[model samples]
Target: MSKRDYYEVLGVDKGASERDIKKAYKRLAMKYHPDRTQGDKDLEEKFKEIQEAYEILTNDQKRAAYDQYGHAGVDPNRGGAGFSGGADFGDIFGDVFGDIFGGGRGGRQRARQGADLRYNLELTLEEAVRGKNVEIRVPTLVGCDECDGSGSKKGSTPTTCPTCHGNGQVQMRQGFFAVQQTCPTCSGRGKIIADPCRSCHGQGRKEKTKTLSVKVPAGVDTGDRIRLSGEGEAGENGAPAGDLYVQVHVREHPIFVRDGNNLYCEVPLSFTKAALGGEIEVPTLDGKVKLKIPQETQTGKMFRLRGKGVKSVRSGTVGDLMCKVVIETPVNLTSRQKELLEELDTSMGKGEEAAKYRPKEKGFFDGVKKFFDDLTS
Candidate 1:
């Protein structure tokens, strides 16, 4: 039987770019691979033919020779394999399944980093703003003291794996290709423990609870995290340990609510104080300070006290505390107080005089009158 054109086998045009050729070849290779075909002889032959075509076309010099002088210039049977290079099968299989089975050039297993751990630390608003040293208990894996992380007994040590002879990998010949894989007997460790440690039981690590002190900086808010290096789980076979993260959660304050760099609170004021005005004591993080309420101050008036809010964690800048005044009506009035209020209201003004003294109330009533007139008219 005659051989088919390489371009036709890969379903790509003669002028196709390297990327297009690779994409077409990968698609065909996956479809016709012998493992997927499950002992189908025709698919197996097709897979071999595709592999042969891919080998010649992917090499620059071989491709150039084949293009110039056709198959006569590059057929292995005719001219010593023409750049299919004997290693093509290994290279192709490595590219296809290296990540799937963790197989590659060396095939030696590597130690993995230990898993990270998270510790939630609850804090009061005051503590978060002032900072503190907190102690945390964490349960994690630690290297065994008896074996010193080697997994062998104190008096005896591990020996080189007899199966792979300390190479950690073995080669298996399949059809016309040789595939390199990790040794199953040693599990790719390259060394086998003859005597196991009593403490860690040949695992090289044991679970234990450790107490660590974490220094928290001031101005840290909820959701802030502090990282402690090498404080997590112990790695296998002496690998590096992971990190421990301290997550902060701030409790709500009864008096103040924090917003970014600002603090907000509602201040209640008596009606007499709101109207007559006076020096009042307001609470602050530091201490109480006197705030002078101006005469005739209305409800919902905002007062800003600079440098009284939280200092920013990142920027180191101060913020302001905003106070909203809410006027409280007098309650539980005595008979004499009620009579005095009525007499005072009557003495204040009437009609045009009332409008001059209570302009806002007069205007609201005028608006209501106009609304009703508009509907009736």
Candidate 2:
């Protein structure tokens, strides 16, 4: 029998990209997998077909040859036998399936690992910094109780397919082309089940919720992820289970904004308090602390509280907290208060240079005068 087109088996166009061909084959591999079908000899053939289609389409040289000669261009009888013999069928399955399952190269079909999963966990900044033990509910696929992963009815075993003689594939001829295809009767597994399990319906898995206790280390910020090995979805055909990743998102606190391990926050002070440089109360994750503002402190003056910020998980050292002081202008002033302020402003002098307390103010004005002098000159 002449070979059929590789593109036809994978259900992709001849001009399909390597990525497109892989996507089509992956869908078919997952849907018609022998692991999912449990002794449906027909499924075994289909699985092989999906595997074969992927094997040829993903390789650059093989794909190029197939595109040029269709199936016959690479067939053994037409002097292409070496190319066919050179391809390792098992390696191809391992290559694609390993990436999906996180396994290493060398595509061994059995003993596969489980899939990885993620859970979004929200926490207060305090709790995240202090570290906590949390219980999470996750949905996953577990082994089926009815079939015990055999996919056969109770008290029954699967039988090899009759049409393909347990090879799971059949030879087909079209005009001058001869190709091998998955046996339709057994789906490619080379086995058949006269009676399927009722609970899982021949699939060896069932959906159930699992409770896991995750230990969150201290000082985790938003967007940090925790990996839980062997905690993801169950693998098919009794392969290894997948891993679970817990993504952390910290809630905002009324007091602080975090940057790395540093904390930034605004502290409000009365006009008198800011002008006179007084001691004020400050908030910290651990507790309240007192900060002393130097006399003549202006608005937006930041005070650094050493060793008061969060302790990093990677580094043991604690970080500093920066408190930006905001001067609150006096509002609802009494008549006497307004009169006193006006008298004070008049006393400070009309030129107003004495009113400025910031460093380099005189230098800045002198520079500005010199700038125009240079411009005109």
Candidate 3:
């Protein structure tokens, strides 16, 4: 039977690019692959036809010849075996399914990089605001000292794997499919250690504890991470080391709470000070500062102190401290104090006269009276 046109076999037009040809081939190849067809001779033949079309269209000279003179220009029976022997079948197969099998075209393996690590560091509010140099001990893998990370003895070196011939990967054929897998002999390292190192036991790294100093910058809050390069686990076969991340977690303060750059705290004000204006001491991050209280100040009143809160780490903008004053009523009154309080209460008369001293109390009761009168009416 006459062969079908290569473009028609792959379901692509003559103007299709090489990328489009390969994409079409992969789709049809997967559909009619011998393994998926399960011994169906027609589908297997269809798969071969797809492969042949893909090979012809992807080649520059053969594609040009086929486009100009049809199949006669590059026919296998004419003088050569056509484009079958030009490219490696395994390479084409690997290009399609290399990621599925976790291997690529067989070659010497490169040394693997080290693994990253994370260490959580706890800091007090004072320490976090002021910053400090902290010393941390980390247990991790370090390069072996005996063989200098070679995984071999002091006097000997590694040899190329005999099974894969130092390629690190071995080809596997399942029916019509070709796959690449890691070589069992060398475990994908491409080299075998005949005489293993005593320190690390044929491994390029050894476990040990290392002491590192990390500088915590000022104004670093919780969830902030400090990266220390080349401080994580040692790489295999002398590759570059990974990084260590120090995660900062600030401890809760006893007197103040931090929100972004601002600090909030509740200040206790005496009843006498709330009634009569006076200067009261309020606690801050730096030190105690005097805050002026106005006459007839109510509870839950907020006072802002400029430039007394935390400084932002990113923008360098200083914030204000918010102080909410809570009035503290006097307790455990003596007989003389009680009599004096009763005399002061008597001086302020009931009804309208009392409203002059406590206007908020009068307004609240007036609202309550109006609400009940409306409900009854």
The candidate that wins on TM-score is 3
Cα displacement (angstroms), candidate 1, residue 32, comes to 46
TM-score of model 3 vs. true structure: 0.72
lDDT of each: 0.82, 0.76, 0.84
Query: Of 1 and 3, which scores higher on TM-score?
Result: 3
lDDT of 3 by residue, 240-271 (tens): 88778888899999999998788999999988
Task: Kindly indicate the candidate among 1 and 2 with the higher lDDT.
Answer: 1
Compared with the true structure, model 1 gives a TM-score of 0.70
How many steric clashes between backbone atoms does each model show? 1, 32, 0
Choose 2 or 3, whichever is better by lDDT. Answer: 3
Candidate 2's displacement at residue 293, Å, is 1.1
> What lDDT does model 1 reach?
0.82
